[model samples]
Target chain A: MSQPVRASLWAGLYCPGLPLSAVWDHQPGIGPVAVHSHQRGQARIFQAGRIAAQHGVRAGMGLSQALALLPQLQSRPRNPAMEQRALEQIALAAYGHSHQVVLAPPDTVLLEIAGSQRLRGGLQPLLDQLVKTLRQQGFRVRCGTAVVPAAARLLARVGQHADSPERLQHTLDALPIDALGLAPGKQQAIIGCGLRRLGELVRMGAPERARRFGSALNAELDQLYGRQPTPLAGWQPPERYRQRLELPVPSERSEALLFAGNRALDHLGGWLEVRDRALTALHVTLEREDAGNPIALGLSLARPGFDRARLLEMLALKLDRIRLPAPVAALVLKAETTLEHRPPQADLWDGRNHGDAWPALLDRLRARLGEEALSGIAPQADHRPEHAWRWVPPGTTRVCTETRPRPTWLLPEPRPCQRADFRLEDGPERIEAGWWDGQDCRRDYWIARDGRNRRVWIFHEHEPRSGWFLHGLFC
Target chain B: MPEAQPLQHLLDQRSDLWRGRRRPQARCTGSGRAELDAWLPDGGWPCGRLVEILPACLGSGELDLLMPLLAEQTRQGQPVMLIAPPLVPCPQRLHRAGIALDRLVVVRAPDQALWAAEQSLKSGVCGSVLVWHPRGRVDARSIRRLQLAARESDAPAFVCYRRHQQPPPSLSALRLGLEPGPQLTLLRGDGPTRALHLGRANVIELAVRRRQSASAP
Candidate 1:
């Protein structure tokens, strides 16, 4: 394959882990503003004060302080997961538009368009299309392309990045060292030494630079130039199985709805048998025809398994709380986030299960028992007497988050099962936990049998209090 | 090029696949019951295609009309899917209709019932998929995929919609329109006996009219 020649383009790029903001009618009159994590200090040329920008209420500024800066500014907690997901989605979408997608660490994407130059008609027309797509999605996109991804990123930081100017070297050289997103202390050190420009840093010898600054500093520079090639190996989408239902009229009644749902589960079950794609989570969307937005419900799996009845049973446990305010017009179900698991090879057996003749038995139980009223127990991240295991929602077949050895019987809400009077039909198991969090507990737990020979795990807290609690039963 | 046969000859040959005629596929056979079998031209529905069942609203005896067929298919040992339907078909009532309760699997994909139907078809496992997407638009592409899936698995896909009227270029091999028709006045004056009327069981070579005259007017 021919190597793609680099050229200028309107690139909508962002660093997932970076904190960026666009103030109302944000103009490029001021200098660089570093969104730092520190408090009690301000950098020179700070364009927008922490108190001014929507979420920038100074690094250590409290929520009230930030709100006071801009009362109407919408606020949302900073979630690295949310940012990463959004970046991956946008990157995937942009990938379809451009074949060569450059993914940066944590969360940054680069689309190289040098090869598409001739077929792109003209630079302005291409820029217009790119701008339109990115702007429509409410993103404050910085469009620029350099021969290198780092150069593009730096140029993006400076307002000089644009589609029309073919002279990219000048634009890149004009951006300050701070635009490179170097660590703040390093940036200050470099600026103090009068090394303000990317050009100034590039002029230094490799050995001297490596000796003065660390390998990270020089690697970043090498990455900015065309000397190193960085490529992103895109992720393959998970295989999904889906079913749909359309209603003649809108409806909210639960019973009037299963006529179609039952059929979908039957289809899914049969499909699962042939391929054996172990399914765990299902995303069900209920679309109200008149309304464009659909309410999306995401179900997670506790175990890697596939059994339509168990899935429906788990779903039934949660469906009672679902309120369809308006009549539903359509139903879409997609089982996703799948894993690979195959049962031992068996004879070519043809099996069929119909509307589970008594599907209502489970449905009725689910309807009566509020979702959380039923659950299964899973091991948790503790070895303490009380924290060794936890009760999670039923049908959660996922591996337990913890791997602590658990005593069979745990009392529910530790009742005072008197040990002297506490039938010592069974022995005690000593336990301890909590090296961190400070609320540590040590206890002597006993699997004692009642006069009726019923087994119970009873524990007496050794410190802080003298109380006996019934933990659980052996069965 | 294949020779085109007249409607009678074509349907006569189709009797084997359509179930209405004596020469019907064993799998296509539905409702050994004589009265109901006679009422249904193709016995019930073809084993491997689409059956479009349109109802005006929910709880309108929609399930009652299809239960007989579902029961027959279950007896034949073919799997069935009730796509995300408005309500679960009554199993007890299905038992009353002579369907084997043990031979059924019910999936509940609340709103994406259409997607669920397509997914079931994609698996090529079930003999039938019963869906209810009342106002959903079943475009030509989705219908074609469903048809292809059913053919691959030798299973059938049935969609029950709350549609006011059927769209052009029907995706179904058999389309039935059930309306709250004239009631049978009996001592059991419970409700109107909704009847299936104005349906297209099969698409024959209905003559195509030239939109514009071939010659000048």
Candidate 2:
């Protein structure tokens, strides 16, 4: 028989008591804590911390016994939602190193590192770095590597570190038959035959073991030894990116929050690249402790773009105007809109893309100065000088077809003027309308020259008490 | 003759330090007025510098004087930013005057107007900046800051104030008082000590050309 050469590498990361760890990380250094879960009509400690462990409170211990060991122990109910989210976060972090990451629910991850082992400098260094990073993220990680996925997971579960398929066989041989995850009756039946370790069980003929334990035991052994394929479903990143980051220090200034937001934005950039999309709108929710509601700032770009510098500039502009009600504890950034982007074609001869940057500049200005401040003029279909045009938001360009000359500046309200002080340069162009709206208008407008010869637009009332009123200025 | 010789000797002694003459820093942006351009150090409106225009009133045809230059800029797809305009600029008139409505940006808010103007000039995004009736008294320092900001982008900047509500003597390189004939009376700049009647027809011809080309397109 020829021995198969091990080539591909796989890593298994096992996280013990993740639910309790994820919660404890939020309030570290407070007190000894235990996570309790109800089982069989009695509450028991499902997970325990180092402090609780020192006091002899461990998993499966009755709640009463755990409390008896340490009277001041703080116990929190298990939160499965937070544990699930923490598992997803570990997967996301692993994505930075390799795309072939598979998540095993309730605390295990399988990473295919055959392609990335050399890129990461070697198997041992990569495993060490992965363990350190997981520990820093508040997870107790036990890692193992082997040629087969199941062997690596079993080795990590049994706290046996193996580096190669040749070494994995010895590590698996020592693990008891219970590591096969068979029914208890079947396990005891195998033990009744005096086969204690998995090596003894495998040495006993496979046909005899299969006939006694049903073919499942033989299949499990084949899978663990790399003889049979193990099915692993690869993880795919979620479509939308919504990341919340707790600031290291509580800040009362919005500008300070920007420093902490860069990490989240970097993650978002990676997420967008993976999805092959560009961001169009972003909504950032600033979480404050004292304030009842989180302050949300929404930025919409005129065109689909993924420029982080532009986003930071807009954020600075918004922060300049905002006075935080209280210190911000966290920031929740949600990408509200994204679009499929294609790279723009560069102009050849002049090397100038006309008006390509104007929209972005206008967007930045609107972000800083506000939408109302930047406006355009829309000519109204009216004859009164003041009603000739109205202020509209920027980018609204509806031109009136009238050829008559009009003033550029119009007063908010017309002022009564003494007609004798000015000379009428252009004769009256009559306008009488707006009767049904209750504000009746009957006026004869003219271009008048002031004492300083400045062009003034005025109108004389024809019906409702004859009077001259100044309204606009022609430039 | 002896006093003149002494003055000449003093001027020659400090030639390296003083240069003994005015070295023009203003780049031409074409004031749109022929006589005014001839009087200017450059043959036109100086670029990368602040030009203060004290209008006789709010509607003293100040915008008309700038229309040709703005139209030319907009024709090239360059933005023309109007900071804190006193009123809504009539779109029809601006369109007829050959200015691109898409390229025009009029900002309001009297308090933020100066800051907006400074940002617009410093950004190098706009081809020209016009701040109309900027509220509050501007000292020479603020004007100098605007000048420096304008110099960074080398875009022409104009700050218009009502003659009645004149600010303290500005440090603008070119300061003109807009008079009755829609004319320019140079109160500052390196020209004659007296007022000069700027030929309005030069810009008027430019505006006519813009209208013709714009209509053809």
Docking class of 1: incorrect
- Best-fitting candidate, measured by lDDT? 2
Candidate 2 residue B143 Cα shift, in angstroms, is 3.2
The per-model lDDT (C-alpha) reads 0.52, 0.76
**How good is model 1 by TM-score?**
0.36
The recovered share of true contacts, given per candidate in order, is 0.00, 0.62
Q: Tell me candidate 1's fraction of native contacts, as a decimal between 0 and 1.
A: 0.00
Residue B7 deviation, candidate 1, in Å? 24
- lDDT of candidate model 2 versus the reference: 0.76
lDDT of 2 by residue, A279-312 (tens): 8888899999775689988777767767788888
DockQ of 1: 0.02
Q: Give the TM-score of each candidate.
A: 0.36, 0.76
DockQ of 2: 0.47
